[model samples]
Target chain A: MTRFRLGIEYDGGPFVGWQRQENGPSIQQCLEEAVAATVQEETHVYGAGRTDAGVHAIGQVAHVDILKEIAPARLMAALNFHLKPNPIAVTDCAVAADDFHARFSATGRAYLYRIANRRAPPVLERGHVWWVPAELDAAAMHEAAQRLVGRHDFSTFRAALCQAQSPVKSLDRLDVNRVGEEIQVIAEARSFLHHQVRNMVGTLRLAGEGKWSADDVTAALAARDRAAGGPTAPPDGLYLTRVVY
Target chain B: MTRFRLGIEYDGGPFVGWQRQENGPSIQQCLEEAVAATVQEETHVYGAGRTDAGVHAIGQVAHVDILKEIAPARLMAALNFHLKPNPIAVTDCAVAADDFHARFSATGRAYLYRIANRRAPPVLERGHVWWVPAELDAAAMHEAAQRLVGRHDFSTFRAALCQAQSPVKSLDRLDVNRVGEEIQVIAEARSFLHHQVRNMVGTLRLAGEGKWSADDVTAALAARDRAAGGPTAPPDGLYLTRVVY
Candidate 1:
């Protein structure tokens, strides 16, 4: 058996998330089908992150094992050809060690969230960004984001449906900055709870609006309750930027 | 008559160019309909540039006359409210002097062209950029682009359908740079012949691939024939970035 690691990019708008589901199409299903068509083998495609619906990815990583003796570049080309019309692309493909699991071997992950902070709605970037009509103080949001950077109980920012065994995780970075008219939030960690990035962004937006202080965010985190956090931001603005191994 | 100068932004993907046509929807038709709904009057919206289909704009300028007495901000908000779900936005509105005309009074116009220079297809920016898989030498393209700048008779780059009285126009700037995986080309001019920017870019792309030199570009310009230039780049990568009056 040959193990191949793949770098993937996709627009998650149409999928039912990264995992396979009966409700609708998924990134994994498409990828697996493409692999089957290329190698005539039914293999499971394992992704580093299961991104939610309407989210996007630029540097998502995955792995698949096939018995067929196909070259990596040839497999990538075949997969891309078979994944036609779908908004997924196999950017890079390489031979991987048998023990290198896509999920378990990932050392870090990074996510980017974009907010169009302007009175006029975004024309070109309609679905890829969360349009916030009210002006946001990006500096305030940046300051508030610093409070959630270190290791702590993130239950306040966790989703009720999250299946993570523990609420405590070390957040390597959570930075907020304004780029042109958009407020961008970048987060990095070893792993994250379901909806953690969206929840944190939603909370930071309140601080951007001057409705909450950094101390208020700390207080909310200290509450250790899902209801204590701000509303979850929509999945449209989130992007799985990178997965490191 | 109260003349209003409006700043417009649009994703030109859904329109049949800027002019109103019987074939399909147009940006002017949408903006005019929105204005009619807001002011209860049928008025003509004059634009600074008549962009082709699939061309986007961030700072497109237009002018309209309304009989109603309304504040500029209020008029802008009302127009925006009326132009819902169209991927169009009225970014700014202000009362203009009687002599001001969106098209005739414009002193300069700037356009931006984006090329996704990567092996992977763009997922998030699919419609907004041209995907060029080959590696492009941006420095070569930039050096070649300088040959097209300055006052020149641009008949080589002019479209066959161009109706301009003269082919001579002063090109103030043409700069090419690589931004991550994307190649950005910025062009500025007092006025341009139809498809001039795209045509210039198409020729410069040959330089990027090492197939043509800067001298070749100068020779193409000196030919003064539409057939001498390269193919016109698609409208998808072009944007009317700014209009100066």
Candidate 2:
């Protein structure tokens, strides 16, 4: 048996999420079916993260073990051929040791949130960007984002239905900047509870709109209650850019 | 009657072209209908340039004469409301002189061409960019592009069916630069022959791939024959970025 690690990219607009669900299609199910069709066996692929619905990915990581021996390039090509008509793509693939796990072996993950801070609605970038007709103070957002760039009990940002045992996680980086007409927020962490990055971005948006200051963000983090945090940002703008191992 | 000039933006994937074609829908037809619906009259709008099918626009200029007296903002909003569900928007609007015309009075125009130079296909920007799998030397492309800038008989790059009276138009600027994984080409001129931008871009692709040299480009321009140049690029990557009057 051979194990291969694959780098994946997806539009994420059609699927329910990364994980397999009974309700609708998923990136995981599509890959697993493709693997099964390629090797003529029941197979499944493991993903590094279970992204939410409407969340895009550029460098999502996954791993699959196959009974048949095949070159990494040939396997990737075959899998891509079977994933045809679907927006999912295997961008890169490599041989991996049997001990390598896409999820457990990961050391960090990164995400990017795109906000079109302009009056005009995005015609070409409708599904890819969050259109905020109001002007956004990206500099203010960047200043407030620095307050959340450290280890903390992120109970205030965690989703109510999060299954994680602990609310504590170390945020490695949080950056906000304006690129052209869009505001991009980049977040990096060892591991994150459900909805952590979205909640933080939503809180930072308050600062960008001149409604809150950096001190308010600090207070929300210290509160350690979900109610203290702002609303969750939409998933259309979120992209799982990379997974580190 | 008051004449108003409007700045328009659109994704040209659905239209046959900027002109009102009998085969399929056009941006001009859409705007005219929206105007008629807004003012309850048979209104027509004239455009600064007639873009080809599948070509996008960001600052396309147009002029319309309305019989009713209405504020610019209110008319813009009303037209936009009537233009619902279409991937089109009126970016700006202002009063214009009675003698002003959209096409005749235009002093300059600018276009942007996008090339996704990578292996993976673009999922989000499929129709908006030309995906070139091979490696592109943007610096070489830029170097060769300088040869085509200035007044000359651009017959080599003009479309065979171009309706222009003369091909001796001055190209003010042509620049090529790489932004991340994409290569951008910006072209500016007072006027252009049909398919001039696309043909030049197609020729530049050869320079990017080391297939053609700067001297070869100059020779093609000096030839002053349509067959002397390379193929016409797909309209997918070309965008009417700005129109100066």
**Please, what is the TM-score per model?**
0.98, 0.93
Model 1 alpha-carbon drift over 4 Å, by segment: none
Top candidate on TM-score is 1
Q: After superposition, how far is residue B8 of candidate 1 from its true place, in Å?
A: 1.2
**Model 1 Cα interface RMS deviation (Å):** 1.3
Tens digits of per-residue lDDT, candidate 2, B140-171, equal: 99999999999999999999889999999999
- Please provide, for model 1 over A46-93, each residue's C-alpha lDDT reduced to its tens digit, 9 standing for 90 to 100: 999999887888889999999989999899889988998899999999
For candidate 1, the per-residue lDDT at A64 reads: 99
Give the runs in model 2 whose Cα sits over 4 Å from its true position: none
Local lDDT at A92 for model 2: 89
